[model samples]
Target: MFLGIDIGTSSVKAVVVDGTQRLIAAASTPLAVSRPHELWSEQHPDDWWAAVEGTVAELRAAAGRSWAAIGAVGLSGQMHGAVLIDGAGRPLRPAILHNDGRAFGEAEELNRRLPAIGQIAGVPAMPGFAAPKLLWLAHHEPEVLRQARHLLLPKDYVRLRMSGSLATDMSDASGALLLDCARRQWSPEIAAACGIDLSLLPPVLEGSAVAGELTAPVAAAWGLKPGTILATGAGDAAAGAIAAGAVNEGDAFISLGTAAQYFVARESYRPAPEHLVHSFCHGLPQRWFQMAALLNGAGALAWAAELLGKSDIGAMLAAAETAFTGPSPLMFLPYLTGERTPHNNAHARGVLFGLTPASGAEQVTQAVVEGVALALADCQAYVAETGALPEQIAVNGGGARSPFWMKILASALGKTLHVQEESGAGPAFGAARLARLALTGEDPAKVCTKPRIAAEIRPDPALADAYGGKLVQFRNLYRAVKPFYQ
Candidate 1:
């Protein structure tokens, strides 16, 4: 048996995969992020490890006796969250999450030094990336920065607790903004500008390489045999790509969890300078991906539910299903939290520009769905700049649960949404598949996605024409709101 784990912002999920990549058992436990105020999001590093122990205990209780000796393990987690450790391995303070945009002011200053950053990382500057988060810590929480000896991404901290070793995967490291991701090495220039020595970062390992072995303490606590290999895994989304079999050039996938990003796999490193899509190294060797995050998907729905409807999420979807949208001019700007791709603005807020008192919850719900689609379309436009339209787009994350939203997305982007073969298992499944890959040395490229032909929502020509006009208006709304935000 091989084990795979994914540490998310709000949860830790574990899965056990047999040699054939068949999932034997899976479990998840939630972890809380303490955001004391607006412009802050933080989590204790210990909170993640506690959940790992809890989940591993559940895994052992369920599958410990029957399985053969564990051969390997792989790990994936949410990216860009900063975890600081002292020389004795004690954490200094809470981790600053990728979603925390307090560094927007810091990002502007960093952008002025963009020529050097672009040459190294092949991507534009963003506050959500790790380096800025660290810079913010240095400025605001210098006591923590002063006491810190090593810094790791959230998942790496979990891995340290599991195997007593320090490591990070290239895919996750790429998001740190401290790496020359294109060259698969640390960028000396970025480190200098941020006043950070590259030594503060963990060693980069490829997706399938052995990161470390489970130590005696972890082995006994988790009831695992000693010396089990732990394979260096990837970021949650990259691991999800491997699990969904979206691993090669031109293959595309989308995840609509707390946040949404359109992931497109590519063979070489390339940044879209014109469209502002994010470029990063992929989990597979010699592979890369371009991602455009919408910043709101399920989050927008949750807010709408809290404000307009009750707290029931299913009710929002059900209401959206009956609601009228095709004939209306109501527009939803999904920038409830600022946007990353295309606009890259942090101050932008959500706007309901065409709302009338006559509008009901369904129309509001439809606008939320359409707003997500338009943001997705912006990503499609970015990839079009590379002269390739995604042939089959695979859907994952919470948005995949809503058929109504899927229909709008399909019609909006004019692409068939191929639902994955399994229920969305998130990135834990990715870790399991990669763990299986390491043990058997199987070729990942051959494990292509055979997604089921779920009910296809063909593009409504009339609705498409209407949305085309509305998209222009949608873009205009953001522009009109730009001054207020600035």
Candidate 2:
């Protein structure tokens, strides 16, 4: 058996996979985000560990003796989070998450100061990336920055607690904006610009490599064997791609998790910063992926559900689907937490235009769904600008559970969307596959084959044409509001 863990922004998930790649047991624990100030998103590093413990305990209870058969562990997690640590390897403060937009000014300054960062780092400096967050710390909290001894991504921090090691994978490290992505190494120029030394970063390794062994104390407490190997793992997006068997060139997928991504595997390093697409190293060696990443996805739906006093998101989507006719009467901009890819604007805010006295919850819900779809359409267009678009696209994550939203997305993009079995378990399942690859020395292609498709959603011609018109308005609306945002 192999253990796969994913430290998501909203939860920590763990899964147990047997020798035949069957998911025998799985569990998850919810997490909370602290937003003490506007545009700030953070979480205590210890909370993640506690959540991991919770999930592991549940899995152990469910899997029984199979837990002891675990050969290796692999991790997948939300990327670009900045977790600063002191010399004692203790967190200095709460980690600033990928969606935190407080460092927009710093990000802009970074781009201005180092014009080559866009080409070298695979994407232009963005507030969500680690380097800009560190820059923010340098200017606003210099004392903390001065005292910090190490910086780790979210999953790497979790790995440290499990294995007492400081290391990271190239796929995760690439999002930090401090890596020479094409070279798969830390960039001294970028580090200097962020007021951080190369020593502050961890040694980068491939995702499938053994990063460290489970420490004896942690192993004993977690009811695991001593010296269990921990694979380097990957960022959530890369891990999801691995699960979808989207590692080969031209393979593509759309992830609709807390945050969303439109990803395409690339054969080599091809920076497409001009299109605002991320060109980063894939989990597998000698491969890279181009992505148009969004800061909001099912999270937008959850927020809307809470706002509308709807406790059941499924019910909300059902209501919205029933009310949907053509395009929504109201247009919603789904930038509640700002946006990336194409726009790259951290100041953008969500707006519901054309709402009237008669508009109700269902209309608003439909508009929100349309808003997210339109945003993803923008992502598809920009990703298309980089290279030839993939003919087949896999859809996964929390939002993919809603066939209504999948239909909306299919029509909006005018393409078929494949929903595979266990789509919601993507990252954790991919992590398990990586663990298997590390333990058995198997070919990743064999171990990471795509799961069986559960459904295929094809575009509706009438809705597609209507969405095409709405997509034009969506783009125009963002440009019109851009000047007003600071």
Candidate 3:
């Protein structure tokens, strides 16, 4: 058995799988994000550790006899989070998350200082990236920078606690903007521009490589065998791509989690920064992917659900399905946390138009869902410019559970959407597969096979036609509102 742990924005998920890739046991523990001020998202590193402990304990109780057979632990997590650690491996402050937009000025400054940053990093220096976050701290909290000895991404920080090692995988490290993405290593030039020391970064490794053995103390406390191997896992999106079998050229998947991503796998590095597409290293060696990410995705739906006094997302989606029929006259701009992909506007904010006295909760809810679909469609259009459009897209994440949303997404993109039986498993399952590869020395292609397709959503011509028109309106709305954001 292999174990996979995914430290996500909202939860910590752990799963155990057998050699054949069947899930044996799974568990998750909820996590909370703190918004101490507007445009900032932070999480306590201790809370992540506690959540991981709870999740592992749950998995242990559920796995029973299978627990002892587990040979390796793999990790997957949210990318680009900046976790500052002192020499003793202690967190200096709350980790700044990828969704945080507090470093806009720093991002601009870094890009200005290094004009070749986009070419070097394979993506523009954006506020949510690790390099910009560090630059922000250097200017605003110099003392913290002075005391910091190392920088680790979210999952790597957890790995440090579990294995007493400071290491990260190329897939996760690629998003830091300090990496020479083409060379698949750290770039001293970029680091110098950001005023960061190369030594502060962790050693980069392949996703399937053994990072460290689980320390005896952590193993003993968790009722597990000592010296269990731990694989250097990947960032959430890359892991999710593996789970969906998007490891070859032309393979793609749409991730609708806290953030949305249109990910396309490639055999070689292909940078398209002009379209704001993110090109980064794949979890597997010698592979890369072009991705267009949006800051808001299912999280936007959650926000709308809360505003409508609904507690359950599934129920809210059902209500939205029955509440409206065609394209919503009420258009929503899902820039709640600003946006990435095609438009790197950090100042953008959510906007709702065409409100009427007769409009009710249902109209607002449907519009929110449609708005997200439209934004993702924009991402699809940008990715298509770089290569042939994907024939089909594997849909996963929280939004994939909703048949209504799946139907809407298919119609919006005018492409068939394949829903895997293990769609909800997301990155955790992929991490488990990576663990299997590490433990068995099997080929990643063989170990990370795609799951069975439980269902498929095909676009309806009528709905597609309507969405096509609404898409034009969506673009125009953004253009009209662009000036105000600046």
TM-scores of all predicted structures: 0.93, 0.98, 0.98
lDDT of 1 by residue, 33-113 (tens): 686976677889999989998988888777766444677888988888888999887788888887777888777677676
Q: After superposing candidate 1 on the true structure, give the runs of residues whose Cα lies further than 4 Å from its correct spot.
A: 58-70, 324-329, 447-457
- Report the Cα lDDT for candidate 2: 0.92
Name the better of 1 and 2 by lDDT. Answer: 2
lDDT of each: 0.78, 0.92, 0.90
Cα RMSD to the true fold for all candidates: 2.3, 1.1, 1.0
Q: In model 3, how large is the Cα lDDT of residue 38? A: 80
Candidate rank order under lDDT: 2, 3, 1
lDDT per residue for candidate 2 within 1-486, as digits (tens), equals 999999999999889989887888999999999999999999999999999999999999999999999999999999999999999889999999999999999999999888899889999999999999998998898888888988999999999999989999888999988889889999998988887789999999999998999999989998999999999999999999998999998999999999999999998999988889999999988889999999988899989998999999999999888887878899999999999887888889999999899999999999998999999998898899888986669999989999999999999999999998888888998899888888888888888888889999999999999999999999999989889888
Off by more than 4 A, model 2? none
lDDT of 2 at 353: 96
